[model samples]
Target chain A: MKSDMSTIVKTVTDFLFGFIIIFGIYIIIHGHLTPGGGFQGGAVVASGFALLFVAFARTFLDKKPQQLYGLFESVGLLIFISLAFLGIYRTFFYNFLANSGGLFGMKITQGINPGYFNTAGVVPLMNMAVGFEVACGLSLIVYLLYRGVIEEGEDGE
Target chain B: MKTAYAVIFMSILVVFLFTAITTLHPMGYPGHTEMDDYFIKNAQIEVGANNVVTSIVFDYRGFDTLGEATVLFTAVISVVALLRGVKKDEE
Candidate 1:
């Protein structure tokens, strides 16, 4: 089976991959204000990585970047778990930072108002952690599967 | 005979599922909404987030998210372990 796609497909993927990643990051960062969240945005970014894997197979296999992605995945999960443990004095996953007037802890205006990015205490941090974990994990998975297929093909011959 | 029994079973199952769906509460009108109302009203002031849903997911129900993250991590680890040496033998 052919590992990489045609010239046109590779060119299009090169053109669009950055935009997809940027859009996913936007969704992740604005998760508290918008409809999207960590998992959804991470999936979007992973799709971009998938496009890259399909378009530039040689680049992926030669670099072995999946190991790096795996490391990032673990780090993101650690950050998430640590954040959860931070409020253990009150309770597990307690909103100790909310309304505390420090680091994403501004009091929100009650009624209709433009939401502040500085508000929403530990939630945004957790969102970013989960987004990072999910994006890296999914991208690693895609790279592994693609590499597996390529290796199997090589072994068959 | 087996085909006739399958057809009958499928039809019965479909009828039951459709009846259950049709009898359920209408859209946007749940039978129990006290929790929803509380979250909607207090999540803003309590969690200090404009998006009530985010507060609920990341704060009120954070344990579940932790569980989800654990599951995802486990899956990725397993995938990596399984596919680690696929090309090594050839090299």
Candidate 2:
């Protein structure tokens, strides 16, 4: 079936998808200092992909196999759980790297001030992990749903 | 008669919803705020993050987030399984 939308949508998606993805990444990485975090940012990125799916044909995105998304989803979850387990010796989900002068370790003054990026310990890492998981999972779902519709259309024809 | 009954039911429902909305606790003034106070005061020092909500979600209350991730994974798995046979020729 001809699934692609009009040229207007395609052009808009081409211009906007990159900015959307970048904004989502910013939200995910700066989650420690900002309002949005993994789930929110991932949803944002997946929405960008959804725009692509709606604007383009199935063949456009079919270059990559579906399993690749599942792999990313699994890897993201693994990163999250492993990060949680790493702090098991101290306690489950302990802030092991906070204020330790390690990677993502930076002390802040105790009052309201502009927060540094290289701080917050495992929180930012976990944000990235969950961000990856949510983004991949949502995009996979959208892709499958659209493919199902396309398959039904073909069968009907 | 049916129209009268429908209007009466809708009026009662609207009254109930309006009362509930009007009686809600004022924003940022919950009856119990000790836990909120603790989180607001100590989240930055303990988690070293400016965003208290992120710190709480990722660090203090991480188990819940784990459950949330599992739920998303399960949803994706179910979708993939259901859609596996969509196009056998392509497979």
Candidate 3:
């Protein structure tokens, strides 16, 4: 009976985590259509990971050193800036990938509505870039707090 | 001890009540309004971006996006500096 109960509890927790992750991804992708954006959605997704870490008492994030988070944060920022510059040069805020256009003129639209999925110019790419930065930045902050490297009295705390 | 606890609880209740009452009050001024539907009518032509929010953020508010990126860079730099010196200190 105890084993069965434990299995049920684990199943419920897994379902909840999966649901949160999926919802977060949906929010990130549809940011242009709604009020939510990459920061909010990425934080939500990271919270899902945090929930899993807490429930399982596992060192899920400890496998990677802080340097990896730093690298991701930097790269995400770079991608975001590059996209902005590309926009400036290409008719200001022009999402170079939204239409049936790519570097090699590949049409990834797949005949979907221009306003539908994968249609918003540069918005999806920006969302993804911001999501990567925010997720890594927030996770790294939390990890530092857990490791006692950052004190509660710090400005962010 | 009993008196102190009662005082603390009463204070908490009072604060909560005050907040609830203040929040419930209706503020003055429904304010004037205007009907500007230029963008709604020609969103694609005006912004050239299908998503209105994207047009606003990247085109209308492009400078704001640059500022936000600068802030993120500053944050990342500070974090990297904070995490750098632990090994030297330990030795």
Candidate 4:
């Protein structure tokens, strides 16, 4: 038996889910240029996922999404490490791409100015990697706990 | 009495903490600003990142972020180990 919430919760969750996710991505991608960073953005995204779980509990009865969350977290971590390794030519964690005139190598403006997307070298990449890891990891944590609670409730009944 | 001794100890500790806080350098008047100046001046040119904090975090001090990520990874792994046993029990 799959138990879910009412129509109002379902409607609200559906409406806000996409916005919350987009906000998270926005925070992560603009981390180098803005005030917020990867962790903050990831937490926001995870909270959106949690909101979905809450509003429509039965929707996540399947374990496949939970597993996918874990896998996505691992992939994020791998990408982060690979990016760090790419800077090995000079030293560990060196900014090799800066000023190289390639991807993410825009000449940084000194003072306040409108920032460009294809700048900041590995900062945005690292931000995305960390955002992916944190969002997936936290969502997975919430799902696992929720699953445990549901199981315990079933056992008692 | 024991109550008197406890009060004295607490007062002394509070006084010591207060004194330490009072002795700390005033805001924006630190004992050392050389490193701060260097990062602010050079972060953009050297790191090519507009946000100095990001460059300092992901480039100049990447190891710190790595350590933080490791800690998070460990926490997730521990949670999985604990919760996964429940599913395994049925299998």
Candidate 5:
């Protein structure tokens, strides 16, 4: 009979999901200058979304969310690949954005200093793209599984 | 007899896993290093990314990440294909 968690769990999930997602975005954006990257950050974000799924399991049957998840996943993959393809004039994955003095492009001083956000060329963009792709991809998987399992349960009932 | 066999199998597996973990080098210092040294030294300048692991994963070895994405995509596709026929009303 129970589909969703207790109210306390729902309240905690509501409070934590936003922060979890924000932290994931931070990890993705700071990937070039920090310890984590797109995959790790995206996984973090997807975990947050997964928590949301668990908190409201009964309401996920709507097909719209699943379609949206698929759309986002496809878009992420497309962007990542296109970005890679953009550097084809030089190489497959060339750092075309480095030192260009444009968006996400700034000259880096030799040796280590306080890291600049704009110094890492195409890395940030790739990180963002991969992060989006991974987040959506993982969210889709979890949502689909939830749907499948829940539907199976309903059939039995 | 079944319990004895299960225990013996589990103990052997545990012993193997324990040896694998214990044999690993302590944190920070790894067993082999020429590649790691090069990457650490050059990734900053080469890829302009401070995180060497990220630089290596996304820049140097981008194909691997692409493959990973493909794998995930394939998984999603298969999941959708399998579940598409299940009607919402029927359930």
Candidate 6:
């Protein structure tokens, strides 16, 4: 019964974390159209995952240090730099993949609304990159804090 | 003990009151300016990015982003190096 209860709690926590991540992704992707952007949304998503680590404790995190937080951080940084350099080649902030011209090479006019998911130049790419970076960086910070690497008081007890 | 507590409470109250009065003024309001309106009108053309905030941060103020990136890179590199050194010491 104790094991079953623990399983149920874990399942609930995972569900909540998944929802938060998805919501955060939505915010990051729609950052061009909306208020919240990469950093804010990314931090929220990272916080959700960080809560999971806290709830599960150190053993869960200790299992795979290389494959987990560090990998995420590196990939996020790479993507961010690549996107920035891509922007530098063309116009400063042109969305490289944005299909302003419709199918069959039709030019979209000023009044025509390109639907959501249209890559608004480098904005979406930058948002995703920053989101990943923030999520990884914040999670790493939280993990270090939990490990007592950043202590509040002196150790002389 | 009672007097000490009362004195602490009074000091806290005075500090809070002073801060509140000093920071907030009765007649302070944001001034609507023509420059703000002008920027709002032509922001899209000037920045060339869909998001105004992204445009402001990445285009208009790109030097700031570059500086921020450099700082983050330096910190991350220093942290990784420190961690590696600690592992070597432990070994």
- Scored by lDDT, the top model is 2
Q: For each candidate, what is the lDDT? A: 0.89, 0.91, 0.64, 0.85, 0.85, 0.62
Candidate 1: stretches off by over 4 Å: A1-3, B1-22, B86-91
| Each prediction's TM-score versus the true structure | 0.89, 0.87, 0.63, 0.91, 0.82, 0.64
Model 3 agreement with the true structure over A2-43: per-residue lDDT tens digits: 011255556777889989989888877777656677778878
Candidate 2 per-residue C-alpha lDDT over B14-33 given as tens digits, one digit per residue, 9 for 90 to 100: 99999999999999778876
Which residue segments of model 2 deviate by more than 4 Å? A1-3, B1-24, B86-91
The residue-level lDDT of candidate 5 at A154 comes to: 79
- Taking chain B only, the TM-score of every model is 0.78, 0.70, 0.51, 0.80, 0.65, 0.56
DockQ, every prediction = 0.76, 0.74, 0.15, 0.71, 0.52, 0.16
- Candidate 1 — which pairs collide? none
Better of 4 and 5 by TM-score: 4
Candidate 3, pairs of clashing residues: none
Overall local distance difference test of candidate 4: 0.85
State the TM-score for model 1. Answer: 0.89
Candidate 5 per-residue lDDT over residues A1-157, each given as its tens digit? 2478899989999899999999999999999999998889999999998998888887765534878888988988898899899999998988788778888777776687798898778889888988998898888888888777777777798
What is the interface root-mean-square deviation of candidate 1?
Answer: 0.9
Backbone Cα, N, C clashes tallied per candidate: 0, 0, 0, 0, 0, 1
Q: Is candidate 4 or candidate 6 better by TM-score?
A: 4
Ranking by DockQ: 1, 2, 4, 5, 6, 3
lDDT of 1 by residue, A32-91 (tens): 887888988999999999999989998778898977898899999999999999999989
What's model 6's lDDT at A100? 48
Note the residue pairs that clash in candidate 4: none
Q: Can you write out model 4's per-residue Cα lDDT over A38-147, one digit (the tens) per residue?
A: 78899999999999888777768654486788898999888888999988887887777778789888886787767777787888899999999999989888888887
Q: For candidate 3, what is the lDDT? A: 0.64
At residue B52, candidate 6 shows an lDDT of 66
Highest DockQ model number: 1
